[model samples]
Target: MALFRTSIRVFHSSTRKMTTSSVTRAPFLLSPNQVSELTNSGHTHSVSLLDSTWFMPNSPRNAKDEFLSKRIRGAQFLDLDEVASSHELGLKHMMPDSQTFARACEKLGISPSTHVIIYDSHGVFSSPRALFMFRSFGHENSSIIDGGLPRWVDEGHPLDTAAPILPEPGTYGLPNLKEGAIKNYDDIVANSQHDPATNGHVELVLDARPKGRYTGTDPEPRPGLSSGHIPHSYSLTFNLFLQKHKTKTGQEYSTFLPPSEIKAALDNAVGTAEANQIINGQRPVVTSCGSGMTAGVLWLGLQLLGVKQVGLYDESWTGYSMRPTSQIQKTS
Candidate 1:
């Protein structure tokens, strides 16, 4: 009897350790199939599915209207612009204050323990921004659906066109922002002119805009904003982390590249040595783009690569460019 009891105790201890390990290794990206399984399993009461689609000013499509027309069943619309705080420099989707974010999450039925799964109409585009927002507000139990709505549609998963029924408001508190998760204009300026001897560690600022915009060879989509990259920043267009796929019916969608492919893309973008520095933790990375939306793509990509010391510049280029004294760099 004593020997049998000892074996049972060992088995229970091993099971507990395995369970803890599984929880810690939870993925930040969930596939369309995975999401479907969870929904089908009747576990959605503890999960919040959010459609986080957004478009640039030049785009004609409206995100909310499309969400109303079609979305994952039981999903709610999370308006990026509506939940954000206003920026003095006319930037869109700036990170909201703690109270505002808490209220937004509570209204969305997203308590701290709720597992948020976000998706966007344009595959992985704006969903990362939504995920980043959740993480910034200390909601670490969040993930983005890989390939988003397009992939879900491609997989022949059913979408609901009916109006969504809102869940009861959840109880959430004003969580503090994660340290080093956000970077401001002044931080950028200091980093741009960083002296390793004084600054302690070198930080890499990566621009997620297209090569032409980074080199000042193409006009910015936003009117009156100058086309130029930030000083000491490297251009690694957000699209590099994604790959296009075609459905059986000839519809096309984008999905994130595998980790190996992503590493190769980083090497190609910043050269092998610099990319290695980033991967090996020799430098921290801060991602930026037009209005900080696409920057989240790069941020997510790095997270996928297991790089932890990453930050997002919430104001990004829009606010940076609008400042009278901001430095601008052009390669073309």
Candidate 2:
């Protein structure tokens, strides 16, 4: 029993620190000052070449940063959109398989310990989604650079336009099997009616789709998926918290967000008109979306906030939206 207890502690410790290496991460992300220490002499380690909302367009390229022509030296470029969808059109940019992720990270020179920050050409569209994905996939040390590239460029920070050189690929070894931090449709369904056989508690479901889609006002972006949200799930668009676009230019990608600012976005969202949930202390979250892909983003945020006992509604709106109205929400 003593041996078993020690082994269990090690397992718990690993899960807790899954996103980190020997390097310690600022809890979630503190004020920008916390990481300002990263600027030793003049350099950032593991920078992202994202174009999140804050990047400025002092020149024509600044608009939407659509070209990503002004990236930081040594930064890795992970496409803000379609990293997952490029191959499996079925999953709307859901977390790609481990092998696929490995290849992409390898191509980008990301490692288990890389400090990842995702920004978009627009302040809000896809960067937060990517940051959330990294967390769920177990890169705990990652952070969103505050204000992203626009802020940096506006500050007259240096930008590099050269194509990124490749680094030796690092292992992106996410397991294929669902583990402690993931869940599927049946898991939700079996527990939907509050079954005592499993005697396990079903989690609170969170829908990351647009409010219009959550309430059936908007058609799903993907074809054939049903329109409504899952039973008990509430809608909250990740983009609502993203920074506004500075221009109408085509979208490219840049890098980073301020942790304090992102935290504020989340804080203001609780029970607000833009967001539909009032997450306090109770009711552990189970994130969901049209096809279970974006839901992972929501799940990722909750994990960052230190919510334990969370899971993903794997089928999300797609599987449940197709169900007969009578079967949508099962009551005990």
Candidate 3:
């Protein structure tokens, strides 16, 4: 009996260690100060800072044009619409397969060993989505710059106006991608509804669109797609996680609110019990929004609140709304 018990103990101990390593926690978000510190500490070589700004088709200012004109010194651009997305027509900004993703990272001098730091021109918009892409690709040493370029400039950091000197192409090989870090329509479809078998392990679908969009009342910015959110998903606008601040020059910009405020907002969106389950890591959360851009905002907010099992619905409502078989719900 003693020998049998000893074997059981060893098995459980080894299992725990494996589980711990599998879910390694690196810093989720970094301030501009920390990024500057790392640069000054002679750590620039291993770090790949990404400018992952994106704009809607109707937006007047082009993200790429803005990057070429002015960007954080030593920041490479991650083209979400062109490089990292699926090649399929009309599926805007969907996550590419592993090989395509590896190639894109390689072009940007990002190898598996690279420490990626993402930020966007818009304070807290698309960088977290880029971070999600990197993490889903199994690159563990990834983080987002808090407040992004707007805050960086507000703090009097230097910007590079000249053309970027691209680094030598990196040898980013195939990675052990984390399947659970991104969810497809099928996964959300399967897991959105509650079931007794998945009592404690349910995946909560969270919509990051505005209340009007969530309720099918607002017209979708993208043409030809139906309005309304996925069934069993809660309406939580991505902007709720952001707080606007004015600079010394009287320019206004948005930045992430403190974790406490974020937690309160999330708790209100999803009920207290469900939010607690998600925060305690008992349940998973999947975030989605129009064309998968603002979904990152919610994904980052949840990460700030220390929720681990969170994912981005890469296709978001763009694909869901157009699908003939899918069902959408609206609340009055």
Candidate 4:
């Protein structure tokens, strides 16, 4: 009953100004309240709220195990590591080709028409990657649930402990494979700014790894990999942008800080003048991370700021450092 009332309220408030593009593009960061209202308002048929939760291999908490224990009502579990076709390629969570991705989408009950809303068990982690992946495949109706599972629970939304109910498999075909959505090794090598002093490049590489890993002062989390970063890549630890906020119910959750603050931090990492010019997609931005996981976080951050040309290094450092011809640079 309460949800019904909430849905009615949302309808009343949003109906007046709702347009085709508004629904089509839908806000990238969805609030828990808005999600609940949509679910209860008979608006869930076309929506797919996925639990895109993934944990590091060594982490004690298992994403699938936890999703099985409890998750948002009408949500599906999408294991980032397992959903793609990267297993045969030896790359961790790298995207598969369009046909494979389309098949995986069918299995998940997602079509090109489905509106994808992703969240993660961790406050703000793997969901961005899933959302980006969807966009890469021409799904424009994709968005991320802000603050993710923690915020959803903190807001007192309903959860189902039972197994997720799967819809009949849906058919998906890539209509608009957004080129330059992902930057592969060859793309990186071609675009890399080897000598920053002499080369005047507009596109900049943003590495989302921690400072220690970025500088090679700390060993990589994955063994058998060198500890360094791509040449001329700027390091902006993904977690550094997450700000703590309290819910109405007094529970704390993580969210990206305000745009101004985020812009400041980004400017500090990249040159202030350069950062200013990167706005509204004017300059292309390439993001990377340890294993292409946290890179999505940074990618999403740039999108939130309305930077148009953001691209993810699909395999990130894991693939780069393994290449015999790749150049690894260390600050120290």
Task: Name the best candidate (by TM-score).
Answer: 1
TM-score of each: 0.90, 0.62, 0.87, 0.89
Cα shift from native, residue 305, model 3 (Å): 1.8
Q: Model 3, range 177-223, lDDT digits (tens) per residue?
A: 68677787788777756651346666778888889989999988887
The 10-residue segment of model 1 with minimum total lDDT is 1-10
Off by over 4 Å in 3: 1-26, 85-89, 192-201
Q: Count the backbone clashes (under 3 Å) in each candidate.
A: 0, 20, 0, 1
Q: Write down the TM-score for model 2.
A: 0.62
- The Cα RMSD of model 2 versus the native structure comes to 9.2
Candidate 2 achieves a global lDDT of 0.49
Output the better candidate (3/4) by TM-score.
4
lDDT of 4 by residue, 244-272 (tens): 77777666667877677778889889878
The Cα error of candidate 3 at residue 33, in Å, is 1.6
Pairs that collide in candidate 4 are: 281-308
Candidate 1 residue lDDT tens string, 187-272: 99989987433453768888999999999999999999998988888899999999988777776667888888899999987778
Tens-digit lDDT string for candidate 2 (1-332): 01011112111221343232343343433222323445432435343343333221133444334444666445556653345633222434555656766567666667675656554444334454566556556665556554455544554456678765666666666534345455555666655555322332445566677877777666676566556655554556655334443323333332222334545555554443212232344544566666554564455455444455456665566666565542453222
Give lDDT: candidate 3, residue 182.
72
* Cα lDDT, model 2, residue 283: 48
lDDT-best of 1 and 3: 1
By TM-score, how accurate is candidate 4?
A: 0.89
All candidates' lDDT scores?
0.83, 0.49, 0.79, 0.79
